[model samples]
Every structure is written in structure tokens, then in C-alpha cells.
Target: LPASQQEHIFNAAWGGSHKTGQLICNACNQSFSTNVDEVFSLYTTAIMNAWSFKGQRHKSVPIIELDGDYVLEAGAKLRIKPEKPLFEEKNLPNGQIRTKISFNSKGEAKRWLNNGGAESWLGRSLTPEEREYLLSLIKESEPQRREPEPQEASTTLNLRNQYRSSAHTILKCLGFFLPDLVCSPLTQPIRQFARYDEGDWRLFAVEPEQFFSLGEEITNLLGLGVYHNSVEIYWSSSSRMIVGILTLLNRVKRAVIISNNYAGSDKILYVFEDTNLSKKPPTAILAEIDSSKFCQPLLGVQYFAQPTKMYEYFYNELVGLTSIYNPIDAMKAELIKSLEEVNKHHTTLEGSTIDQYQTLYLNFFIKLGKVLQVSVDSVKIDSKLQEYGFSRLRLELKGRNITDPEVESIIVQAFDSVLSDWTQNRL
Candidate 1:
């Protein structure tokens, strides 16, 4: 491989530093970016934006279109994008006309009112007297505040292309970490399928029932959040197979089969990027592991016999995990935001402050209960509080003065106790 032909194997969108090598030719890199990488990136835009992940090239979060006349901006902020000014006029029998106009902001309303919007709605030129009368009748209304609600959106994805992209990514990692193995004849089929889409190869696989459970265990072991991106490649001597597992946001998991009959010694390469820490470069680990540690019995040839069934199973698994994790992530974000707000106003702890903290705690516990498939109520929470010797603190928090140092200490300890239980018991 020449210097000009070498290219960085990892996609910049996955939050990593760029390192060019002889892993892939420049032409193949560009082609894969156009065909495979773009599709997978589009499919993961929401998750990427939600986590505020910025790549080497893409430094800002992209706008996400919603179901209605709104687009998500800067990840969480919603902006209304109506096609036209919102205007309605009703003529009454008593020789009166009632008009209504809506705008996203007061400045927008003022701009529209000055830019012939009134004349357009009236369908005629406005005389000085008419304009003055309209101005006199119109009054500015106060802004309305409402609680945030869930948003619904639909996205069409090509799972086949995404699978290919995953396989290609694994191949790139191998090229960077184990160049000889990636260049060997054993990886030729993967190269043909991932680069040119030439073979009917079973590129990705998962045990439909055990995939999520296994993913959760791995996530806990790695101390990874939903925003982290990680990939693992290992050759299992016992199973005589080379497999690669790709995880995005700790939500989407897929195992790519790189080789079925391997003759090399046991090797494991793990690469990960914490999207939250954009300044840090991605980490790569090449280590020796037990020959039997990462073996997958389910990736045998028989598993690929029914491609349609496998695809369907993978599709359903993706959808189910997305539905379950997205909302929890949102809730977690809200909890963090609320906590920041509390810290910002920490000078005085009033009754309202206690109430706000309790509200935040209740909301988080409810979400945790739902995720754990457990019923949680005040009684159960109080029982835990009793175990922690904070049962009396809860009652004292209500009646005690806001300036009491002991009260604050008790509340903090109780909060810590709850969090400890959650982490220890998998709540």
C-alpha cells in the first residue's frame, strides 16, 4: 500500500481521532463512506445528537426533523418551522371580524405584522385609518408555558447496508490492530462482501433471545453509558471462529462473523470511544485472552441457513431496544438537568427546594422501576429509607427550617443511600 492509498478506517462520525494507515485504499474508503457509512449514520442521527457526539469532521449536532412542523435543534431544543404565517379570521353576523395569529416568537410576530401580513390576510390594501384601528384593537398576549411531551417520528433504514457497514468497521479495526490477519486470505470473503457487496455472506448474527441480556452484562462490566461506542474483535481457538461485536450507544448490538475456520492463536482487540469526552482520543486494547472466553457457538453455518428469519429477529431486537432505551435516556437527561438547576440555586434550601428534590427523586425512581419491571411505591421506598436509618429524616425535612445544617446532611445521605441501592442491585 502506497502513502496516497492509505486511509483511516473508522468513521469520523463515531467520535474518534483520524489515523490513516494501509488498512483500505482511498477509493474503497470513499465508496464505503458514500454507500454504507452514510446510511448507518443517518439511521443513528437521533442517538448521536441526543448524546451530543461530535466527530473529527462533523463538529456540530445536525438538525433532526420531527413529525409535525418542528425540528430538533442543538439536540434538545425544539424549533417550530411552519410553512407560512398562522392566521385565521372569522366574520360575525354582528358586523364584527375576529382574527387570530400565532408565531413562534414575539419578534417573528412583529416581523410578520410589519411585512404586509395584515394586508395579505385582509385581502386588500390597508388605509392609514384602517391600520390605526387594527393596531388599536390588537394586544400582545403573554407567552404560554406547557410541559414537554413525547415526540413521534418514523425513519426508514436499510438494515442490510447497516450490517455491511458494521462488518466493514470491524474489518478496518482488524487492519489497524492486526494487519497481517486482515490481509490474509481468510478475510477475503469479508472484504468482498463489505467493500463491493458481492457475496451472499451472513455478515452479522445475534441470538435473538439472549442478545439484550448479554449486552446488558457487557455494558455493566465496561461501565459504559448509552452514549459510548465500542467494538470487540477476537479469535476463539475453541470455536475456531473470528467474531466482532459492535455496540453503539450501548443500545444497538450486532456480532459480525469475520471467519469461521481460524488457525491463529487467541487474540482480542477492543476499541472504544466515550462520545461524551470529545477531547479524548479513542482507546484501543490488544491483549491475550483465554482461547475459550469469547467463543460463540451460535455462529455456526447452520445459524446462517435461514437468512430471512435471522434478519427479522435482528430487526425486532433493534426496535425493541430502541423503544426501551430512548425514553430512559431522556428521563436520565431531565434528571441531570434538574439536579444542575438545584445546584445553581443552592444558597437557600426552602420547602419548595425540598419538594423539587423529592419530585426529581420520585420521577427517577419511577423510571427505574419501570425499566426493572418492578413495582415501586412510597412504602417500598420508605422501607429502604428505614434500612438506611433515614426514615425519620424524610418527615423532618418537611417541618424543619430551610437553614438547618443537620436536615441538609440527612437529605444528602438519604439521596446517596438510594443511589447506592440502585447501583448495587441493578435497579
Candidate 2:
């Protein structure tokens, strides 16, 4: 097939076509969702996960770059950066963007960059300390993000700091103090472990709060371990591998490792970490493998480049990383597992203007409920809420004298809590 056709097929395989219909994959036979949007969303995320892809816009703006190829990556707080560089940039009215990105070396960074990513810095450009500072400032200000606005930058910082719960941590930042023998493997495939100066040896480890305060960009490094609301880490003595544990905020109840691979296709990437009398118990289980039949996944995964390292690191650093958070009664807990994704995207309220706006919506729901005013249990204010109708109510409130400050204040509070309720009830 032609390269263009191959790329199109590759993109399609990752994300299905927009034309929805019943289709069966011989591989799974189970019907995959025929929805184009769902397919594309997951495709985008999976591609984004590869840490490839070139520069794309978030709301249509390109991000800041540190060099021709290297860019200051952004996280979800900034929408993580990819490993791309040296793409063209175009100055949009509101932001800058990379105009062209092809399959260049670092596995098509422009793709990732375009998908809410920036450039990645490997090797030594600055000390971890220096980078950490700039990352913190960027999180707070995000002054250099794709199409970042003054208000958005300031708001991003405030939200990060405010909700900066050490809960639901996907990965942890490491300090140089890892036991000399506990140092990260020298040749991990994952880019997070690229050797710095002389192998990432550090005499000092910065505090998490202090580190983020520095306001620079940070690269995400993966390790096997238990991550919960309180993130922590430990490593094996051989230095061949390490594990970490963390606590995600309440919002991100848990991270579901949808699929992972380790050991050529011979081993299924399950056990989050291997344990021995010397190694101690691990924190979570990343995959369960059929060590015997491990080749096929490799077929599709080959395009990922450096599969050995990625898989090796997967086995060594990310297996059994999740079992730590599994509930004692596994069967019963399954009920809540489905909500994990919802938690990931929603925010819990802390009194803020956004929260205030939520309160207004709640009041609308409440007033609407009263209009329907039936039984205490029967009136579902949110269920009947309509976007256009509600806005009309708000304008009518203000258009006349009925929407007084007291009513407005009530609306604001309801608005603040609205999202929380929506997530809670999906109302």
C-alpha cells in the first residue's frame, strides 16, 4: 500500500470511521462502538499516549517552544507535551502553532504537539531544579501554552494550586536521593529516564510543593508501584527497576491500564511488579501475560519504535502498580469502577467564581423544581433543566427587577455546585 494509504489505515484502525454501523473485529468479535466520535477520541488519546504526534492546537492555538525541535511540554493542567520538535510555526490571531509536521525522527512529535502537546526536552538543557521551577510557573501562568490567555493562564495556576491534592497521581517526580543502587535503569525505553548529566543521580530531592512552585515544565516518568491519593515510591536494589505509589485526587478515582505489553509477545503485561523474597510485595498489578503467546500484540505495537525498551520498562516498572488500590471485596467494587473516567474529567468544588456560577444553575433548577412542585421526592430540578430555557430565565431575571442580587447570589452558589451535582447525578 502507498504511504498515504498506510497512514490512513493506521489512523482508521486506531479510530473507527465516522459512519456508524455494526462491524465485528475477528480479533475481538465483540462489537466495538461504531460511533465515530468515540473511536476518534480514544484514537486520539492512544496516539497522544505514545508521546509522538506533532504540534496541534488545543482551542486552535499552537504552544510555546523552547527550541527548534524541543518544546516546553504541557500537561492536562497543561495537556502533556509530546517528543517532537523542529516543526513549522504559524502565528494565528490569538496563538502560535506548528504549521507542518511529518514523520520526523522522534516518532512524529508534531502529531503529539498538535494534540495539545508541546516539545519535550531530553538530555541536559537545564537542571531538574531549574526545569521544575519553570514548570511550576507555567502551570500557574501557562504563559507560553498554545493560545494561552492572561485569564486562562492565571486561572490554570490557581486551579492547579488549589486542587493540587496529592491524590490520584498518575506518576511521581523523583528526587536525586534514590538509593545509589536504587537508581533508575540506565537503559529504560521510556523517554522519562533519558540519562541526565551522568545518569540521573541526585544528592537532593525537592519537596513536591516546592518543586511545583518553581513553575517550569516536567516530563512524566513511569515506574511500577502503588499510586493512590498519597503518592509514594520505592525501588529494587538491583536498580534494574523501580516502583511508585500515588493517590489521585478524588476526581480521578483510578487510572485504568486498558492494555499493556511486556516481554516480546511471550508475556502478557499484567503483574504490576514482580516480587521475590528480596524484592518485597509490589503495589499494583499492571498486566497478566500468557508468556507463551506474546507475539501478536507486538505486530500492531511495532510502529511504536523501541518496543523492547517500552515493553521491558512496562514489565519492570509498571506491573502490579494498581492492585494496591483494588478494594478488599473486588466483586463489589466493580460497580464503581465504571465511574473512574467520569472522575478523571470532573472537578470537585472549592469555593470559587466558577463554583458560584454553578450555584446559579442550581437555583434555576430549584425554582424550576418548585414550579413543578410536586412531591419532595418527585421533583427533579436538574432532570428538566434546559440550556436555552434556563438562559432565558436568567435574562428575564435581569431584564426585569426579579433577578435581584440575592437571587443572583443564590444563582452563583447553585452554579458553583452545579457541576459537582452533574457529575454526582450526571443531571
Candidate 3:
């Protein structure tokens, strides 16, 4: 038995007088039979004793960096215990509350920041840019309304004056005007100008008109509310039109719906969601005839030609992949060849790192099939390993190949159908 260094034999006597003796192990302070057979069993039992494992304190240790090529199983569960918060709120001299937190671990902090936690949420100190932008908004504006004369307010403030003061107080208390404090603006529907020739039709708003004329009889007839998309169809009068015109243009290439309130025009604008020109235009077209010469384009119409968000997302993905693997042209070529082959086979393929190649192949395959007009049931992209893999170094597709003659021919036909579009797009 393994014993403490302090262990020593208490006593030992080998003779007939001490035929069956007791042996003392000073380490454990326990006595055992000194008879040959029993002593061997006692020593064996002590040596073979099982001790429960005492693990190190997990809270104090930092997480080790994960391997770049580490592959995790599909059912893997990752647990991350957050570190102590490093920052607290600190009031600034300018009455703005700043964060006490500074970037102690830049890499980890950056990752945390990128995962939708703004610096303010992290209680991090503001950058100079943020500080300047905030300061500009926070600076008080000169009062637009005239102050009450001393003679007029002999006692308490009037109701109007009280309301203004209350509003100002509320704005300050709620931090409505503070940078990054307000809710995000509402999402506007996609807007596009239907260009037929030199003249293009677009949605426009009329000059802001009061819904309730303050002192006029119309005030009794109409309640106060903001008006939107109020356009003049004829020289006679202006009326409110439903934004349904956008939906009509999306569904049908051509459709005419009468506007009951407005007499002169019944045409709706045409706006298709296509990214290319050769794609067949939707069967319906919506166009409006404006007999009134007074209709003018709204402000900021010239800057509406930017690509849709989907395209931007695609660009971002490509840029990210390029950054990870430099000389992207080679990767692009390899990807194109592999994607074309996958399209040609019309079968599922497994990838080493499922996230990257799977996404890339599925997107390309689906899009290619769409352009070719062959609607497949689903794009197949399986993982090479049953579990999830993180490494992205592998390029070759390394799984089962579809050998069905009929399916292969069908894929070839689809590829041939979109060959022109593919070639043009590749260039």
C-alpha cells in the first residue's frame, strides 16, 4: 500500500512466540494481521482502494482557444460561463452617463461586440466618433416659440406653457433624443421607379397639409392625423390612395384599378423584383396616367438604384470567404467547377466542413436550377462526418456520387438550358 512518507514499522518480531502478530501502519494509524496470507490481502486491498477524483476549480480558469480545424459532433453541447462584468456606469461632467468599462481583452470584447451587443450595452467607453455624434444631438436647441411677456403671466404659467415644459422634461428623462437610445425606424417597403422611357413613375407625397384647419369649420369635420402618399391625379383635386399599388405591380405586370376619389387617372406603377432584364416580365403591368402637370418627384429619388439587401448579403459572404482563403480567384474557380458538376449530377453531395461548402453549393445550385427552369425537390448538401465540423480547409467534395443515368441526363439537360446565362454571368 502507498503510504505517507512518515510511515514506519511500529514493531516486528519473527519467532514462534509471536506466531500471529499485529502489524501497524503509522501512516493510516491502522493495524493489520501480520500472518503471511492475511497481510498480503490487507496490503492488496489498501493499494487497490478507489479514490474519488477532485477536479480543479473551473471558475478561475480561462477558456482555452479552440483549434482552427476542430470538428464538433452534430449533437455537441457547448457551455460558456460568462466572465465577471468589467464595467459600471460612470456619470460624466457634461451630465452624460458614460461606461466605466474599457477594453481589457480586445479579441474577446470584439467578438462579443460583433454578436449584436453594442458597445453601450457592454458598458464600454464611447469612441470619439460616438461621443461627438451624441454631443451634437444633446446640445439644446433655441426655443422656436416666443416667451410670454412679464405682464401676461402675473401668477402661474398658462396650460400651453405647462405642456411645452412637460414635453421637454419627458424628452430629457426618456433620453429619446440620445444617441442609440431610440427604437429603430420602421422598415419601409421596397421602392423602385418604373422606367419605361425618359419619364418614370414613382410614389410621391404631397405638401404636408393640416388635417384639421385650426380655426376653420373643417376642424369640426376632420380629426387631426398625418397624411401619407397623397397625390394629385387631376387638376381638379388631390386624394389619398392605398399603398396597394405596390402589391399590384408586384403580382401583375399590367392592371388598371379606378380611384373613386380621383377622376383623371387609374394607372398603377410597374415594379418587378427581378435582378436581371432577360427574365420574363410578370404577366401584369400597373401604370398610372397623371393628367395633372403639377405632380413632381419626391426628394431622394435619385439615390434609389442601389442593389437589394440580398445581393449585399451575398457580396459579404464572398468577401468573408476570400478573407479566410486568399487568392479567391482559385477558390472561385474551384467552387464554380464543383457547383456546375453538382448541378449536372442533380444529386446530394457531402462536404468536409458542412457550413461553408454546403451553404455555397446550395445557394448556387438552387439559383442555377431556378435560372434553368428545372424545379428540383430539394438541394442536397450532407456533412462528410455525421457530426458538425468547423475546419474550412478542405475543398473537394468527398462523398457518394449519384450514378443514375436518367437523373444525370435530366441534370445535363437543365445545365444545357441555362448554359448561356451561366456563361454570361461567369464573365
| CA shift of 345, model 2, Å | 32
Cα TM-score per model? 0.72, 0.19, 0.16
Q: Please list all clashing residue pairs in model 1, or write none if there are none.
A: none
lDDT of each: 0.65, 0.27, 0.27
lDDT of 3 by residue, 1-427 (tens): 2334221111111000111112122322232222111212111111111111111111211222223322111111122323543668878899998754333344545554555455547378667786555445334323233332212111121222212222211121122122121121210111111111111221121122222211123212232111000111111224422122211101111111111133333333222222112222222233344434435411111111334743463345334322222222223334556656555644543343234445654455455454346653332222221112212222333343544444334333333333333445531
- Model 1 lDDT, residue 221, Cα: 69
Error of 1 at 337 (Å): 3.4
Worst 10 residues of 3 by lDDT: 10-19
Can you write out model 1's per-residue Cα lDDT over 66-127, one digit (the tens) per residue?
A: 88767766534566655565678899999999877766666666666678988787798989
TM-score of candidate 1 against the unseen true structure: 0.72
Candidate closest to the true structure, highest TM-score: 1
Per-residue error for 396 in candidate 2, Å, reads 28
